[model samples]
Target: MATSGRREVARRILRLTDGIEESHEVHEPVFDIKDTPIESLENAVNPLVPFLPDIRKHAVTAKKACKNPPPDGLTLDESASIRLYSMEWVPHDKCLYVVLNDTLRSEDGEKVKPWFLYLKLFRTAFERLPKQHLTELENYQRAVDIGMHSLPSNHPNFQQWKKALESAKEN
Candidate 1:
């Protein structure tokens, strides 16, 4: 994946999960990613394979994208799959995310069946990713959680940010 594509995936993962431990999307009757077979990224998007008569070139572009994985430790092919999912071809509405998200949003569970293998691969890549850590905002939230239970309500530093704001207003 290119630098921009990896950055986008990182940003989306953080935005989607934020303080949550895991990011998830599930349909009715539950298609477990664990049960789905893991496959090469090219094979995973088999429906989009433009090998024979199909004319979609973006699929080929995605397949031809960098095979190296990002720092997250996903396979080279898995990274390619992520890149594919994020790419936009000439027609903005025809993007893979557009179609995949539509399938995800569908009321009918049957629509999602075709995407099982890709979903498994995508979720596997996600599993390898680190979440909501090290950044200043997440650091602050973590600090708050650490003391939130131990501090007494009457303590000077208890909800100290609120007190500090009120003090500033009076001054």
Candidate 2:
């Protein structure tokens, strides 16, 4: 069931970014190691460039919609469940991943999860994306520890990010 749901979500996401492509190659350090200097991290983690304004707008709206969802709209937990499952380049297999807070459960003690959507963005989107969303992507990466095992205890804004994750985990 979850697999089919994921496919549907992926289809929707692909439709949303249809026609977008990378205008140029993107170069950045691999996300396999931790403790890499932030200044030295040059590659844009999640290349969301071509869909810029719309993507950012969608993110902002999603954040708000998650916070105060309508009666028939997604709940906070539901929204958090809808996350970036994968963003990878076809040739190299490089990817950006998200870790979900999976504390939400159903009455039967099974995990009542949402779909995970995968998107393939153009490499050029990295260069064209707005700074705010870029920063947010970094935060998202940090939250999920995409490249590393865990976020550093002393990393700046760690508490705030943790709190945000906690809020999303709530029922």
lDDT of 2 by residue, 116-156 (tens): 11111222223333444545655764535543334465544
Q: Pick out the ten consecutive residues of candidate 1 with the lowest summed lDDT.
A: 14-23
Give the top-scoring candidate (lDDT).
1
Instruction: Report the poorest 10 consecutive residues by lDDT, candidate 2.
Output: 112-121
- Per-residue lDDT tens digits for candidate 1, residues 1-171, read 699898776555433333232223333653555678898765677754332222235556766775554555667766667677777554444567767765665556767777787788877865554443224434654556454555466644444554644453444
Cα lDDT of all candidates, in order?
0.58, 0.33
Candidate 2 CA-lDDT value: 0.33
What is the Cα-based lDDT of residue 168 in candidate 2? 43
Best by TM-score: 1
